[model samples]
Target: MLQSRLFMNLKGIGISFVPRYFFQINLSKIFNEILKYNTKELEEIQVRVRYYNKINQFFTPTEKEKIGKFPFKKTSYAFDAYEISKYFKDKFLWNKDFNDVKWTFKDPTICKSRPLENNKNNILLKLDKNRHFCFLKDDLIFENKKDIAVFRGAVYQTHRKEFFHSYFNKTFCNIGDTSKEASQYRKNFLSKKEQMGYKFIISLEGNDVASNLKWAMSSNSLVLAPKMTCETWFMEGALKPNYHFALIDNENLAQVIDHFRTYPKEAQEIIHNAHKYIKQFLDKKKEFHIGILVLAKYFYYSKQLDLNELGYEREILELIK
Candidate 1:
């Protein structure tokens, strides 16, 4: 009992000494310890953030992520304890009684069934993640775009590969890698500066969901992607199709391009709205603040927490307010 109090006090003292990024990186580890060991009297349990790098790859027992390791970096997580707990129940926790505990929950290329299928138990908190960094430029204009659309990196699945290849590396389609039979497509990698300059950024479902959309929206360019049935922490349910991105219907790429090109003013409006939305809510500080609420909600549902036990008590209250 005395040792637990000491641990909590040590955590309290140390939290103030570190930068938020330090906490963001280590919160998962810290919280995992609490989740595993601290069930006695719940007080300010550290809510954590992480994601899987393995994606679809199976890990051996040793290679598998340790309990509580949510493996993303660069950006922090707004921990969705409710959704995360559901994951735990399905993949790890086996107690049928946990069904009464209740919970809920992204990505393409790495495919999975439609996201939010069990949203009845899922609780969404806020959006947060890390991606390519580029300086925001006020001078960037639609005309600065070098191509109609630009996509880099590899695509999995035979059909998806063929779709990019059929474009034949010209005009509307300039894929980066040549190995895929878009042999004519440019082989040179597009730098971040060049990607930001383009008028339309292409986001496709890879693995499970596209990670590019968040950062793409951060840039001045307009995002073009299909209506994503898969989801992430902040996308899908949170984002309206036309509001957050220009729709790219299946096999209707040409028509979509013509519409956006002919009516650029409309495209610009969507771009403006997207930029404003991502920038306003997704900044770093708020990212951690949102993470705390996710943890709060999980505890609210599964384990009652005394107000004094919370680490970010003020932030959690602000959610209900």
Candidate 2:
């Protein structure tokens, strides 16, 4: 995560520290006007918009008073939220917390949580995007890489510490902790490129979601992780076990690794499925549209926007059908 922060700060410096969110917020209105979704495109957006914001009740004008906007402290999180909320502009409500927001509001509220199954009010946007949304180019194919599984990250959770102890000394595992307070493992930082040399890359859940999961999937190596507990815009819930990733737990990690090592074809297929899942997120225009539409639904349900003012009436109609 330290690496990601430095990269973004350098990137911000390159662009004179202009908030990219501010530009996107302004351009969103124009794009919303000019962009026309065909039936299929609208349908896709409808599915995602509904998934993000499941508010079914229309708040009365009186009921809308309960809604509240939250001021986020982190600049990156605030900027990301503004990119969508600026459309509604102080109209919609959001969770006040950050880093795996766990609270649920009585009224519909936007949030950036792991999207637990029952947390319907937590309307997810791709917040802390620079840290979570990384994709890489892999020149090494699965067959050419070493047969070992590698993991390199901060040990924030007890499960992470257990994982480090479980396989750190194994011949087939190369794992380390990046946190400063960590003991002997503190010196074992592996670069992203270095981890690519192995056939499997471990992606354990940190504070919420696995930050490395995106780039790990993009690599030639297969992603090795347990079932995802939380998800962001990448929709970890939609991913299939043993298809998009090699699902493993503390008990089955080595067995799963050995199975993949013996059956390289299956590993390649899982990598293929991961790449397919990733392809949808690469379309910048569609992603922007989906973000706007998700917030539009938020405003409508909160009664901040009148029914007639939604602008996506045709799309909404088709969505209901």
Candidate 3:
């Protein structure tokens, strides 16, 4: 859970710094736009418009109305970075509340550091060998329990060769559409998969889509992580609905052996150091304990039982009192 004081402090810092960054970048664009429209004929037109009408009337009706309704609207969209920064100043950043902060996760395998374009075939081969994991391809067969399906980012025909080689399951993750089309696309895909006796899963990329994906999964099939790991700020107060699983790689044979060899010294020390830092900053005694209590209450009230009943609650409460 996030403490109010900590939230306020972080919000203040972000509000102060982020706008400055935005403004510096936007200012250059504004200057470029001004230069592009700096011709004599454009200057004459501007002068005539300014003289014939009030300075505000030079703007389109919609723009004028927006300016009138929200005085900062013009500055908010100002091209220059500095002006843009000024526009955002002191405005409560929209997502200050954790209730408004969305959570999501993404497929780490699909989001590997290597460029997919350069290694698509190799990736496909790897998927074929590791048949338990899902692979994104078109023309996926909806057969066997061991196979999980995924949608290819590009054309179906191009992915057919890989699809032919793999076992098929009904569950899949899609990546092609923007948010506007996502709901519809998901519906259609689920319907098709259902017809073929398969279930579907959705993996998303950002906070914007996380809540929607959660809702979809609660009603339909499973929902995978909607955002990448790096996007999440773990301090946020709210926990996403527990229907979604956090997918992590279970240790392989090599990892198991390495852990045993390293556990007594370096690995254990590193883990201890991480815990100490977390305790110092995030879990400092009673204050942190209170935050957890408050979060438990909120989850109980929200009917989010999974969070309320997660295994740590008892141990956390024991520490709190």
Q: Top model by TM-score, which number?
A: 2
Score candidate 2 by TM-score against the native: 0.84
Distance from true position, residue 147, model 1, in Å?
Answer: 4.5
lDDT of 2 by residue, 1-321 (tens): 778677755553454344444543553354444257776776777788777777777653333432224343575676666655555544444433455754565555556664467777667787888877889999999999989999888877888877777777788778877887836666467889999999999999887788899999999999999877787788888889898999988778889989998899999999999999899889877876777767666666655654355455554534422
Q: What stretches of model 2 exceed 4 Å from their correct place?
A: 1-35, 60-72, 91-96, 102-106, 310-321
| Range of the 10 consecutive residues with the lowest summed lDDT in candidate 1 | 93-102
Encode model 3's per-residue lDDT on 153-204: one tens digit a residue: 2212223223322312322323232223333222223332332222233333
lDDT digits (tens) for residues 120-224 of candidate 1: 223333322222122255357775675577777665545456667665455775556524545444477776567777788787765545656767777777888
TM-score, per-candidate, Cα-based: 0.58, 0.84, 0.21
* Candidate 1 Cα errors over 4 Å, as ranges: 1-114, 120-128, 132-139, 178-186, 308-321
Would you list the C-alpha lDDT of every candidate in the order shown?
Answer: 0.48, 0.73, 0.26
User: Considering only N, C-alpha and C atoms within 3 Å, which residue pairs clash in candidate 2?
Assistant: none
As for lDDT, the candidate ahead, 2 or 3, is 2
Window of ten residues with lowest summed lDDT in model 2: 61-70
RMSD of each: 12.4, 4.1, 24.2
